[model samples]
Target chain A: MKKVAIGIDIGGTNSAIGIVDEVGTVLTRGNIPTDRHSDINLYIDDLAAEIERIIASTDVELDIQGIGLGAPNGNYYNGTIEFAPNLRWKGVVELTKLLSERFNYPVIKLTNDANAAALGESIYGCAKGLKNYIMITLGTGLGSGVVINGDLVYGHDGFAGELGHVCVENGGRECGCGRLGCLETYCSATGLVRTAYELLGKSNKPSVLREVVNTEKLTSKLIYKYAIEGDALANECFRFTAEKLGKALADFTTFSSPEAFILFGGLANAGDLLIKPTKEYMEANMLEIFKNKVAIKPSELPGADAAVLGASSLVWKELSK
Target chain B: MKKVAIGIDIGGTNSAIGIVDEVGTVLTRGNIPTDRHSDINLYIDDLAAEIERIIASTDVELDIQGIGLGAPNGNYYNGTIEFAPNLRWKGVVELTKLLSERFNYPVIKLTNDANAAALGESIYGCAKGLKNYIMITLGTGLGSGVVINGDLVYGHDGFAGELGHVCVENGGRECGCGRLGCLETYCSATGLVRTAYELLGKSNKPSVLREVVNTEKLTSKLIYKYAIEGDALANECFRFTAEKLGKALADFTTFSSPEAFILFGGLANAGDLLIKPTKEYMEANMLEIFKNKVAIKPSELPGADAAVLGASSLVWKELSK
Candidate 1:
């Protein structure tokens, strides 16, 4: 019988479930609407049923190993998801305890989506054999997972590695966290569009982005589309984003001196359009000994399978331990 | 026979040698001039002789366990002192290898002085029983050692925890490291003097400090004296230094969420004058989750014996591991 681990990605809108084997192969996948179930017990029941249905449909004889989850505010230490703003389940939800009771599984690991991505990258992706590196997810808000000496830094509380919240411009931009000049305010996917708007307001530069200015349609994807086509103002937005991220990365080097920084999520898909300038600015701002040492690379995990693979890798990591 | 470890604290001017037992008592102590010996071999020979003399002077029968060193720019991985600006040795000096060979001792550990302080605090000082904390030494230049999960964060390379070089204000002050606006440039013993000078230059509201302004007699000690005596400008210097340090500590909290920040060295000796304002500013600048969570306290290690004790603790830590 083939041993398999359950991988679940809990998003605000929907939850993705996948049965993954030892080698990161997703055998069967399914999804359920997370927003529809306001009640915690019903949500867990529905999730359990979905997993059972997926397992029953699979042809191979499978022995279930354990379950691993990637959620918005997942705490690895407490096995709970606490006060995630986008999730309907308010306060601390005993996610792992509830799910473990349903499945009767002895091992269940949970961490934030960014830390999960770091584990996946370490176990199966580009960061293999690297003991120290940082995983940065440039999504709606910048999220990060710092790996040092092959273990994730959980800090005193489980809330370490919030690199997105690190101040870059010292009161330049306002953040959702009620802080001034957070790196996320200028470096995330939403931040790219905000940068485009700021560039449009400040200068009379001729560009394709001008047409979508002040509209709800101003998005990072739109900015990337114009940037690839050589729109000067759109390209400048990426440059500005790189400038903030690059400087922040340089400052981060003085703390951990990580081997590399792995970029994940939507903005990272822009490839060299973003990575090239970020590396340049990081090098320019870096201290002497750290210069040209830390590499900034895009995530090597396949975009479609990354979320499930990351979640599954947690189980594999625990088993190996 | 009592088990004792040899502790060597290498400074720019002098080297202090101590023989310490497991319970943190200094059995016998002596010193040698570090600046007098430009040749590395002669320096090693003298240091070895000093250690031997100190060990022989102890009244109790002792078995030497190991020797540990704390020096500027000391690298734990390489066990060498590399490019220490204050030291006469230009390049990487193989101090550990040379000394170990001289003493024929197999176990010799070396790291930067701040890291030693952290190990000392963890083993014997106020930070006992704490698994996570940061050690900040506010000297001529600021130095730091970060502890996470009961172990020091050494990063990928041996050169982790160089928090002194982390920038506070972009392009604000010129640092000796050829960087602009490093934390050390605004918050160290020298930084306090620099702040006092700046305050003196800008505002004429200063009383006592103006007499010593631009003179060689200007020092952090003088500033502390005037501040305690109700000098407004002198107090402002402490406040400004606290502002930069407090904000930087808040940013650092986002990275490693340590339980406490233990302050060491001369500037930190101002007690409530610096700690009070620093805690206030750190709390004001901190994120919601970390607010009122991290304590800012002075180091409990005796000022006279701290260096040697810190060095000796390195041996104890390694042995237990």
Candidate 2:
């Protein structure tokens, strides 16, 4: 029988679970609404049942091995999720302890969602065999994972690599984290939409984006579609986003000089529209020593399953440890 | 027999050599002028001879272990000094190989000056038990050493922690590194002097600092003296320095959330005048998750022997590796 790991990636609105084999193949997977279950115990109970049902439905003869989970504010050190703003579970939630009680697994590991992404990329994606690099997930918000000397930088309090909150413009834009001039306010997918609307009003450039009735419903993908069609305002919005991202990257390089920055998520799919300008602006801002050295590339992992696979990859890391 | 290592600290104008034991004690040390020899080979020969003299003059029964060196732009991976602006030797110079050949001791190791300081702090100072902290030496120029998970962050290249070069003001001040608004421009000893002049012109407040005959020769010590004497302009200058330093520290915490920042050099000797205001300002700028958590403290290592002792700690790290 083939040994397999259970990988669970939990987010604010969704929870994805996958039964993965050694080579990173997801034999079976399922998604459940994360925010629907306000009661903590009921959510865990339903999740346990769904995982059991998925394992039973699979045709492959598999030996259950270990479990790994990635979630917001997940603590690998103490195995608890502390004060995560998005979670319905208030204060400290011992998700590991609750899940382990329902399963016969000997090893159950947990880490922040971004850390799992970093490990996943290093083990199964574009960052394979590379030790020094940064993995950034630019979605509703920007998430970053810093790998130095081939290990995740979990500082004294297990809360390192918060590059999104690093200010790009002093007192510029108000962040959701309640700070001014955060990189997240200018570089995230939502930030792209915010830029789109800002530029929509700031300039009089004729574009397809102007036809959209609901500006609040505007998504990064829709903006990318318009930009691909040579819409001037949409292209300018992406250019604006890349400029802030590049400037922040230049400052970040001065800290731990990474070999590359692997971008993942919705905005990254825009391809040359974002990457080309981001690299151009980053190189323009960096010191001559750091110029033209760091590569900015998109993550190779499949977008739909990347988070689940990344969460699963944590088991391999823990096993080796 | 007592095992001892030879420690050499190469600087722009001076080089210090010492025989250090495993416990980070400097047995005997001497200084040699560094820039006097413009030729790299002559400089290496003189340094090796001085190291030999220091080792021979020691009275204790000692078994020579190995050698360690700390220099600007020292590569831990290559054991060579590359493109050090402060050094007279311009391009890549194999200082470690030459010294190792001159003295037949094996296990020669090299790291940047700030990295050496970090190792010294972890091994011999307040951070003996702490695995994660940042050690900053605020001398004529600013230097930083990042300790993560009990090791110095030597990234893809041997150069990783260059916090001094990170932009704080964002096109606010021109730095010697050809960058504008570097943290070093406002935080170093020379930066304090620059702050004094800027404040002198901006303020109408009476100050003892006005009595200085040569403004160009003004020092951080002089500024601290006037600040202590209740001079409002000097007090404002110190406050100005702390505010910049604090804001940068808050921003830096977002990168690697160290437990504390261990400060060294002449400016740090001012005690509460700099530390208190810096702490207040840093906490003010930080995101809520990082506020009031990181400590900023003075270095406990003796000033005279710190560089030599720090350089010597590299051998211990190598032996473990």
Candidate 3:
């Protein structure tokens, strides 16, 4: 029988699972909608039932090695999810303990979704063979996983890599975390819309963005399309975003001298529109020692399966150890 | 026969060597005036001769396990000193190689004095058993060594913990590194004097510090004395230093969430006068998760001997490994 480990990526709207082999090949997988139920136990039971149903019908004779879970507010050290704002659950939820009780496995593990994505990148994606790098996930909110000396920096309480919450503009935008001027507020998909609105107020540029702005239908994808079609205002919006991102990257490099910063998620697809300006400004603002080094590249993992691969990589990593 | 290691702390003005045991007991030690000879070879020869002379008549039948060297630009990776600005040496000088050739036994390692001090603190001083923390040495310049996951964070290159060079105030103070507003320029002994001078221009408060308007005559120790004696201007100068230092510390905590920040060097001796206000500001500025949890305390190492114990700890650590 082929040895396999289950990887679960828990999102706000959906959950993904995969049985993966040692070389990052997903042998089998399935997905389930994240129920709106507020009770923590019911959600875990549903997830457990779904996982069992998926693997039971698979043709491949498999030995379930372990389970790795990636979610918001997941603590790698404590094996619990504590006060995840998006998940209406209050206080500490021992997801790992609940899962292990259902699956009789000795190797259950967990990490924040961002860290899992970084592990996936490190093990199977763009950052292969690179020991020092950061993985930035540009989704609804900006998330980062810091890798230094080939290990996740868990700090004293496993809450170290809160890169999104770090202040970029000193006293600029208000964040959901209640902190003002957080980097996430100026660099996420939401931040892009905020930037487009700010630019719309300042500029008299003739563009399709004006129509989108009037309807309040401004999305990062629409902005990318306009910029690619030679809209000056749209192009300027990306430049503005990159400028903040580049300066933040330059500041981050001072702390951990990584060889590269691998970007993942929706906003990362803007590609050269965002990357070129980020690279230019990163170089411009970096200290002398870090000059001409540190590559800013995109994730190599398939976008659709990145979270699953990342979640799987966590179990793969643990089993290997 | 007892096992021992010779720890060398090489400074610009003087060099100190001590024979230290595993438990941090300094059996015997000696200091020699550092010769600023143009020829680098003569400097090495003199250092080795001094070490040999110190151990010549000792009654303890000892096996010199290894030699650990702590210098200005010491690279732990290559065991070389590379263009330390304070030192006249131009190119990469493999001091460990030179020492090993003379001693016939393996001279284990080298690291910058600050890193060595951090290692020393972790192994024998206040930071013993604490995996995550940062040690700040405030002398002629501010220096830092970061510890994450129970080891020194060397980064991609050996030059990771250059916290002094990290820009705190954009276009604020002129740094010796030719960078604008580096943390060191506002937090070191020199920074304290600069703070006092700046205060002298702004405040007309009656204080003894006004007697030294020239930067040459002003020192951190003198300002510390005045602050202790209730000079409002001097107390304000310390508060200014603490605020900058505190903000920087809060920013750094985002990267590596250490349990505490251990402070060392001349100005740290001011105790509560400096630490209290720094602690207050650092807690005030820190993220909600980190507030009031992190301790900012003075280093427990014995004065100048910290570098020696720290250097020795390197060899001892390697041998234990």
Candidate 4:
């Protein structure tokens, strides 16, 4: 029988589940509406049923030993998800306990999505054989995981690597975290759109972004498209985002002195449009010792498979530990 | 025979040597001028001779097991002092190899003074039972050592935890490291003096500091005395220093999320005049989740015994390892 691990990546909008074999192959995949089930027990039941369906449909001789999950507020130390503002679930939910009871699997490991991505990178992505590095997820919000001395830095609190909330502008932009000038306020996909709005509002420059400026349909994806097509405003937005991200990256390097930084998620797909400026700004602002030392690269794991492999890698790591 | 470890604390001006027992007691101590000899071998010979003299003078049956030294830019991984700007040693000096060869001790361990201080804190100071914490030394320049999961974080290059140069301000003050607005630029004892100078230069405020403003003898100690005597400018300087320090602390917390930041050195001895404002400002600038969680406290290690004990603890740690 082939041993497998169930990988679950929980987001605000949806939850993706995949049955991953030992070699990181996703045998079967499925999704469930995470926001629909407000009741915690019903959610667990539904999730377990979905996993069972995936396993049965795959028709493989699968001996699933453990399950690994990635979510916004997933705490590795505690098997609970604590007050994930993005999720419909409120307060500390005993996620692992409830799921484990239903699945009858004792080895269930869970960490924040960012940390999971870091583990995946170390095991299967760009950070292969690298003991020290950082993984940055630049989606709607900026999330990060820092690894040093070959272990994830979970701080005193389970929430150690909150690089997104690190205040970049002491009092520049107001953040959802009730902090001023957080890195997320300037570097996230959300922040990119916000910067685009600010730049367009400040200047009378001509661009395609200005046409969809007032519409709710305008998104970072649209901005990325405009940027790829040589839209000056969108390109400026990417540049501005890179500049902010680079500056923050320089500051972050002073803390851990990582070998490299891996970029994951939506904005990472902006490619050289974003990477070049970020590298330039990071080099410009970096400490002399760290100059030309740290590399910023896009995620090496396939985009569609990243979250699943990242989540699955958690189980593999836990087993080895 | 008393099993002892020789502790050497190398500073810019002087090097202090101490014979310490496992219980953190300093039995015999001596000092040598560090900048006196630019020749590396001569300096090592003199240092070895001084250690021999101290041991001979003590007249104790001491079985010296190992020697541990803390110096600026001390690299644990390579056992070398690399380009310490403060020390007369210009390039990479093979400090550990030279000392170990001269002393015939195979178990010679060396780390940066800040990491030594952190080790000392965990062993003999307030962080005795704490597994995760940060030790901040507010001396000539701000230095830091981070302990997470009960181990010192030696990053990819053995240069992790260089919090002093973590640019708190992007383009603010010019730092000795040739960087702008480093945490050390605003939080060290020298930073306090710089703050006083800035405050005096910017405004014609009535205060006692104005008398010694232009003199070379202007010191943080004098400023502390004036602040205690209700000098508005000196008090403002303390407040400003605290604000800058606190803001940086808040940022630092985001990276490691340490339990408490234990402060050491001259500026730390200023008591509530510094700590109170620093804690207040740090709390004010913190992320909502981390607001009331992280504590900023004075070091519990005795000032007189701290350096010797701190440097000594490194050896003890290595022995156990």
lDDT of each: 0.89, 0.86, 0.84, 0.88
Candidate 1 differs from the real structure by a C-alpha RMSD in angstroms, to one decimal, of 1.5
Clashing residue pairs for model 2: none
Candidate 3, superposed: residue stretches over 4 Å from native: A201-211, B32-35, B202-208, B214-216
Best by lDDT: 1
Write candidate 2's Cα lDDT for A168-280 as tens digits: 87888889998888889999998998899888888988878888735547888889888898888999999999988887888888788899999988888888999999999
Superposition TM-score, candidate 4 onto the true structure = 0.97
lDDT tens per residue, model 2, B262-290: 99989888999999999999999997777
lDDT tens readout by residue for model 4, A154-248: 88878888889887775689899887888998998899989988988898989878788766577899999988999988889999899889988
Reference-based TM-score of each model: 0.97, 0.96, 0.94, 0.97
Interface RMSD of 1: 0.9
True contacts kept of 1: 0.73
Chain A superposition TM-score per model: 0.97, 0.96, 0.97, 0.96
**lDDT tens per residue, model 1, A1-321:** 998888899999999999888877899998998988889999998999999899999999988889989998788999899888889999999999998788876579898888889998998799999998999999999989999888888888888888898888786789988989899999999999889879888999888777766564888999999999999999999999998899889889988889999999999999999999999999998988788899998999889889888998899888888
Per-residue lDDT of candidate 3, residues B1-321 (tens digit):
878888999888788899998889888887876656657788887888888887885789888899898898788888888877767667788888888788865556998899899989988899988989999999989988889988888778776787887767756789887667888999999999998888888887887787755444788988888788888899999999999888888878877789989999997888888898899888777877677778997999999588899899888777766
RMSD of each: 1.5, 1.8, 2.4, 1.6
Work out how many backbone clashes candidate 2 has. Answer: 0
Prediction-by-prediction clash tally: 0, 0, 0, 0
